[model samples]
Target: MKISLKKTDLFVGIYLLSAVMFFIISIPSWLLDFLLAFNLSVALIVLFNALFAKEVLDMASYPTILLFTTIFRIGLNVSSTKLILRDGDAGKVVLTFGQFVGGGNLVIGIIIFIIIIIIQFIVINKGSERVAEVTARFTLDAMAGKQMAIDSDLNTGAITDKEAAEKRKKLQQENAFFGSMDGATKYVKGDATAGLIITGINLVGGIVMGMLYSGLTVNEALNKYTILTIGDGLSSQIPSLLISLATGILVTKASSDGELGDEIVGQLFSIDKVLMMVGAALVVMGLFTPLPNYIYIPLGIALIVVGRRLKKRTGVEAIEEEVEESEAEAQEIRKPENVVNLLNVDPIELEFGYGIIPLADVNQGGDLLDRVVMIRRQVALELGAVVPIIRLRDNIQLNPNQYIIKIKGIQVSDGEILFDHYMAMNPGYVEEEITGIPTFEPSFHLPAIWITESQRERAESLGYTVVDPPSIIATHLTEIIRQHISELLTRQDVSNLINNIKDNNQALIDELVPKLLGIGEIQKVLQNLLSEGISIRDLVTIFETLADHASVTRDTDILTEYVRQSLKRAISGKYFPSNETTSVVTLDPNIEQEIMSSVKNTEQGSYLSLDPERTKKIMASTGSELKKLEDMGKNPIVITSPIVRLYFKKLAVDYYKDIIVISYNEVESNVELQSVGMVTA
Candidate 1:
């Protein structure tokens, strides 16, 4: 049988093997030298990797690497201590370090080793551990908000599903990596403590062994054993210091597009004025103080030269590069495929002319974008549907004060507003007229005037409803969206809605979706409800109703009527108070009979086929009654028999768009109804 191991497996095997070898009684001097060298090389590699990594996830395994290297260093400390206790010399590496680096002074070597430990354990390691903890906490706290943003982007078509998934995965990995680092920092702290304890043991144990067992004198034993113990401590502590520094760099470094070294250099020297000021200050100090001219003058002059060169390069070269990049982007935009991308349309778009730009700019105190996001949230709560992002842009072809609202590339409404003026509407009881440019409110087409800022208080004193430019636009956009919501509900949106509730209602969804009724069929039912201004927020009830009657009727209009009857309370509460009587217009019995008689049923659906003359009479009567109800300050609702409700709605929709048509079945038992007017034919 052949045995094959992957790279990761082989690396793990080598690590375990090395861990076991640290327990051996004796290690050769040459092997001890090799281990010390390997420790230093690993520390250097870790530092470079941390400094150059483009993203945190790119160094996902850094915590593991840190743990393994720390263990290896501690093992080396143990093995070298054993060697020193057995003999005066630990190895060539330790001996050279003690004699050359410390000048063969035991006190100097011991002091140097103590300083290294203090810096690593008290300063670098402590700070890195704190940073790791804070970073991990912040990453976890922001994870939910970031995930929601990704979902919003995907729903708005700003990003694809795959891209959203990748971003979510990267975010999760980053959280995990930082969390691991939080725990791994403790390893470094412990390793430092262990090193200190081991060095103390080596010094005491080496002294006792030399005097009592080898028969050396007190002074002689002190000199020989102390030197060897200091050497062993310095050899292990130096690499420990390097590894600790690397951990500090990894945790404290900010994210950047380039390497850490390049970022440090570029940012530090980017401002030429600062460098010039520093150079001038240095030159002044050199002249006023006893500093050598040979050292300070040349350094100052070199700084001044470099500052001038950087200033010229950044100013001229940066502009040229920007111009080139813009030209390249323009060329790419002119390509056929890029132009074709413009053919894709937003579900809702708001376009304005150049004069209204300040209304959308946040720096100018405009809150249009903020208002738009709030509008989306409000609509979702009210309508029980996710509103796609509305794309806003400027169109130079339009008049400076003109704005247009579009749905799916077709303009639905257009108006002009004075950006610098306020709209003051006479609330049907204003005692005085305000002197200004005469206009009408864009949303409701109510008569209004655009008054100056000085007239705002005067208009309000006269009971006029005054609004700013943003409020006017926001109100108009809201009304437009409310009117066209039916067109916005797609199969994908229905799927999202179902998926959102799947965790709690999995069985209901499994029974109703793609089995009893397809998603497209369900979408049509929802659109029907939305078209009639009925909120489907109670989706559980809606799905249950469909599951009960979907097999009986395949017609969406009929199914929508069933859903409406099931949501009677929600519908009633929308137009009237729960305890108040619902005031509505009642169709004459003769007209109801005529409409019910003209209803034709086919494989397609049920519809009315009344004669032209009769249709005109019915529309004329309904319009007159609806106007009366509107004048009385009562919202107009038409009530008829359940069998003729759908047919009557079809007849009046084109002419009486504002009137809500409901059947007797849609009225709940808890509410009372009063006939405010009669639509007679």
Candidate 2:
């Protein structure tokens, strides 16, 4: 179970509520007074500590602060009592000070709260050095999921698996070493500023609590300590100064973050030694017959300076150690070349297609504007033609007179041939010419003449086999027409063409493949096309239509049946049928018998045939849809029967042509046009 921030906040709320209710309700009246004062001062401090400690020492920070505060407060209480019991003069001064500062107990409790707050702040406010480490860790954790997501998407056919895997692998490998570097960097940028701010806030709160408690109680307890002098007030605050100085130094030392077991100069000096020095000095001053009130100021300032210097020195050394460690770890991650290679290349494939186009110099109104330019340089080796594929820039429109032609993708020589030479021979179209010259029987023709030889030769070699009348102007027109159609039959165009074909002759789809492959140069271009994400089946459909236009096929019953079956598969969205069974439920004998009984009961020796039942269903769906158009004041033909679907498919080509024109006009005018208007137009 992943822990969320919301959960953490909820836990904190629960902890706070439990603490407030239990501690406040259970204590005796007198004890409760003391506990209330203590809890009030410490509540915010403890909460801050809880929040900060999570970052400081993996849960240890919180418990450590709690333990230290308890011990220190108790020790302060003991010392205050000893002074009051042993020396009348000191006792008088101490009592007066304690009462004025909200009593000895309140003062001590407040100080402890301040100390914990400061410690937590220091821990939480760690600097930028750690940010990189955190980012790196986050990156590493995210990589595996990202890679898996890519794999799942690809395997499920949402995208190509190879592409997804490769992209993810690249990112993961690049950032593998980043995490280590980040960890070391963050360790050196300890929480000094954060610790200081926390300490400052706690110090202010402690001061306010101490002042309120002491000021209020001091007058009441004043007569108890007759020996109390003006100087006692100043002298009494020495411990607070000493504690703050000691804490600041301690926080700085903690920030150093050296080796877990490394011996430091501060470690040698020891917390015990530091405490003993302060304790002995205080005791000696107290034992004196006449203690100077200003004695603590110098001592407090000295201790602060000493602590600050110590922290500064140790911190620098710790940072150096961290930097060296990072460099060393980075070195270890450098595996032998082969091991590195394993994680280097992603499992993704980026099929190289046409090169980038130069659009800056293109003129929107020029003849070249409507022409598609394909960069054949990369896949040029597979095609016989110079241009491998076509891509038209913006500001170009398809010619209304042009019809798209596509050749089935077949591997061909030089990657430029219109169709595969080997497949072209399959339909008995290849033969010796009548003029005793070895030439293609279906010679390339065009409706225009005076066009450059480059265009004519390109069209012929690519299998355009332009067949134009002998008139020069006719040849030029034919060439121009073929070129315009070629430009329009780009990858996008071919896809739309296949969709239209599939809508009509789905049964003959398999046979359509060979015929489409018979179109010139399309087969040669298929390899380059795979990268563009054109499906093999759709590509075959486009080629088939082009082949059909070039060589009209006679209507045959066998071909018609094939077309129908293909259409059914398409309508049902069954692209690839498989023999493998994926469902795991086993058939029960009793259920099987029951199913057979049901079937036998329903069986009336009636065979399923094309009839009114099926036709009625189609009509209900289609006619209802057509009625919707009519309600909207649109004139749409209602063709429900399969026979009518066939007739419309052949004859309704002009209907779609008109629809496209109306759509174009609406777009040009930037006005919303109703489908009814479009249909009527």
Candidate 3:
């Protein structure tokens, strides 16, 4: 049989042995030497680990290790105290520490011991405790915001579910680790306090034992026992000080890719100019002031040499990197695969000029990526579809402040933004004018001015809507997405929607998809719905309606009208309050009869073949009625017969793109309708 032991078993055995050592009345000299050496080794190991660990969680067992090591130190203190009181000498470790560390003076030894205690108790331990407390509080406070960011990323498809779960787990562990460190600092404080008390007892008890039992004179007792007590105090307090320093380093360290030493070297000396300037200043001071030439002159010369070397090395590295990149690009251009790769294009792309780069760079405090993630989530909820990831890059050919938004390789919208200025838009009622650079708001084309950041408060007080540059871009992107969503829905997007519902509605999918309509046909219907800003979130009702109507007619437009009638309540609620009366424009009786007669049906599709003059007259009348509704601050909706609704919409789309045209069959009977005006020809 083989006997096996795990790390946990070894740790438990060590802890039990330490606990047993505390109760032993006396430890042999060899054992005393071993314990002292072991204590010093543990303290050094902890100190180095704290300094070199790349991540705080890498030392997740630090608090537990701190507790056990503290106990082991205390146990060693007890055993040493016993040896010193029983015999005139403890062990060679104690005696050697007394003479060498104290320089053969009891007062010097005591003062040194007290200084260590003060430094540990007042400075290192206290600072570590406070840092751990603040870190724990801040981590807990920001937990909600961090979790929201993770959720937004997940919903936007920026991260997979497993990656999100891992991030959340790490967040939880950070909170727990900081909380534990806060409590662990208390142990260090107690250990320091115990060291002070134990040192005092050893001094007094040793003196008493030397006079009463060991038959030594007063002078002899004072000399002998005071050195022994100070020695014992120094031995224990040195390790205590090391451990306290380690705790301070651990608590104060920030998140970084490398160890503390590497971070300090990289960041502190990254700038050669700063070193050169300091070196020059030091040389000047040494020559003018009373400072010794041996001190400042040598140091200044060394610094100057190092600065020049660093500058030279950095320049060489940059040139080498550029050369390598150029060669790689040249090679890539010759490859056949490179030409093939150019055939693919992003569904949506955002290109900005040089000055706008900071708005998307993470290191410059830009949150455009985060804003884009949030936009995707918002679009999903409102439009009932997941948007593809938007590719962003810089284009040098454009003006520095200009940005262009493109959909499927076609430019949809372009705008310019001032990076350091706030845009204040007139809300149509401000009496006083503010002086600034005049511009128009990109999203709605309203009159706006780019003002300094300091003017934000005054602009808000004047009832103007103030927006930042990133917000301007985000708003423009939102509007462009809403306008061009029809072009963005692809066959793959439709397939993703199907896969999402296949588990619960597999039978419905199998019956409707491919049997009644293929994916491409379904995609077209969805595009039609999205083009008019209709949500396809209710896909179950849509597919069922299609199943009922597909057998009767294979025409997508005719089938779409049937689907719209089935979604009458949703359509009505979008335009008006639920169960509330809506005011709308209606065509004149004669005009409706003429439009009905001119409709031409063919094998391909249906279209209006009205004379050009008659078409112009109908459009002119509709425009006039729309203007009247706008003057009353009302959005006008045109209600027409179901047969002419699509044809009328096709005619009005060019000039009245903002107006909504719905069929009578698409309005629910529960909704009350009032006629606001009439369109006559």
Candidate 4:
């Protein structure tokens, strides 16, 4: 491949090289004159570019520019000092400043040069250094918070992953720019100081050389050398000072909008009242004080006229804006409704009323958005499922304290919260209660009380589980997501999971997905596992199991059983407490036999086709046995034979959805289970 450079690149390349050459090789006065002019032009370009750039990132390479300009400026200073001592004339540019700007006065030119140094070094350069240092520190410190905000926006579907990536890139550029600027200010300060030193050296060298070689008297040599030195200093410092000013402006600029001029004008002078008052003050000063009335009086009167006219125009603009808004509203009402927008639905939505708004508003110290992000992460860890973006919105139709959680546009559950209070629930052991508004916990419908901040400490002391409003909403949202995570796992989500697996285990994914089972089939199997509160995180095992058994059976229910049995260790760890005996109920042989006999295997799938009356008896007996386990402070786990486990779970789902049915094949042998009771019909 061949490479080519643009004209701008070549120009910049040559210019920087010339700056270095100027420091080594003596050039003719004309060439020096042209280079000095070129330097001034470049400085002006940089100053304007820094001034008008809408964002600092627009000038992301500014620090490098600063280094280049400083090197070039120092080269000019050195070359001119040599010319002043040897030939007594640097160039026409330096001479023009000496004669014209100083009005033929050596003292005036020297004083002016010193003043420039003071302003640039003590004021502009110093302020820029401080501003850049602080900006860099603050920018770096804020990066973590900005990154999390981007992630939360991405998870909430407020921004796409691509947009988030762009934002992160911009943030990194800003950090780099500010960090480099913090150091770049040093170069400007050093350049100004070096110029001052060079000017002084030139003054001394020129006077001594002129007196000895040119046959000039002491005063003549002093006047001649001092004028040229001041001229050279002025020519160099002017451009250097402009650069310093640009640096200060760029660092202090916070707007990513228009130029500095526009922001200053619009912010300070746009207000009619401020303009009018200033006009009044100027007019009063002109009349009452000894200041020149001719200068102040006309300016004040013109300002007063401008302010009154601006006020009238502003009023007209406001009326025009109202007219435009009314016209827009009328046109909107006349237009046909947008059916496309109405057809789309967010995957998850948490709409609350006005009073509950603060609980979701991040600016008001609410962390509901952060909690929502954590809920997504928690679901991924717990069930190996990606919860869809949860949307937060406010609805005026709801009662002030009410909020509803919707899945696919339909409200599944709702809860009311007193915004300024905490919900305290007894954890079954606390006999003491604090006084508060009585309520029920929305997630579990357990009895709770809404207590004020004053009572929160007392309630916690009494052993009540106290939760704030945001936590309450987050908890309820999490529970709802977990309960419906199975249905939420679409084919796209399954494909995403497969893609994630392909990153490391391509062979397993390639062989298992679409070869033995389609995405829908895989989805159904995963859903089946999720529906039973089993995690599918170990997709390698799940996919490997499917690859082994899917060729024999495509039925999701039967495949699910194979998966569950394959994941017995995980299942055992989940349901059976660690290193402890678990008291559970076992299904009677008659009931297991009946469940298996009633299972109907069709081309679609397998399900229990038990008689309705017999089903009622089975469900009643199952619930009663599970209730006994519950009363014994144990989870409602049922142990059944391998073949009847799936069918028995199906039979019990109509009445006892919370029942945890496991097969003898699905429990690890190390797990100890005590059969406290048996379910018989």
Best by TM-score: 4
Candidates in descending TM-score order: 4, 1, 3, 2
| Residue 542 displacement (Å), model 1 | 2.9
Measured on C-alpha atoms, candidate 1 has an lDDT of 0.86
Candidate 1: stretches off by over 4 Å: 1-36, 55-57, 60-96, 121-194, 197-217, 268-339, 420-438, 448-467, 501-516
CA RMSD (A), model 2: 23.9
TM-score of 4: 0.90
Off by over 4 Å in 2: 1-17, 22-350, 353-641, 644-681
User: How would you encode candidate 2's per-residue C-alpha lDDT over 5-46 as one tens digit per residue?
Assistant: 788678656545544444233322343234323533453455
In the range 240-274, model 1's lDDT, one tens digit per residue, is 78888888888877776788888888889989988
The worst-scoring run of ten residues by lDDT in candidate 4 lies at: 255-264
Alpha-carbon lDDT of model 4: 0.89
- Residue-level lDDT tens digits of model 3 in 1-681: 999999989987976687576667677767887788878888999999999988888888889889988888898889888888888777888877777787988778777878888899999999999999999999999998798777656644568779989999999999899999989999999999998899889888998999999999889998998888887888888988999999999888898888899999999898889888888888887888999977898788788888999999999999999999999999888766756758877778889999999998766988887888778878899888888777777899989999999898888889999989999988888877788899999888888999998999998898888999999998899888888888899999999998888898988898888898999878888888888888888888888888888888877888788888888888988986776677889978788788878988898877878999988999999999998778867777899988778778888888788888899999877888888889998
In candidate 1, position 158 carries an lDDT of: 70
Better of 1 and 2 by TM-score: 1
- Superposed model 4: Cα runs more than 4 Å off: 4-12, 20-28, 79-89, 143-169, 205-228, 363-365, 434-436, 548-552, 588-594, 641-644, 664-666
Score each candidate by Cα lDDT: 0.86, 0.35, 0.86, 0.89
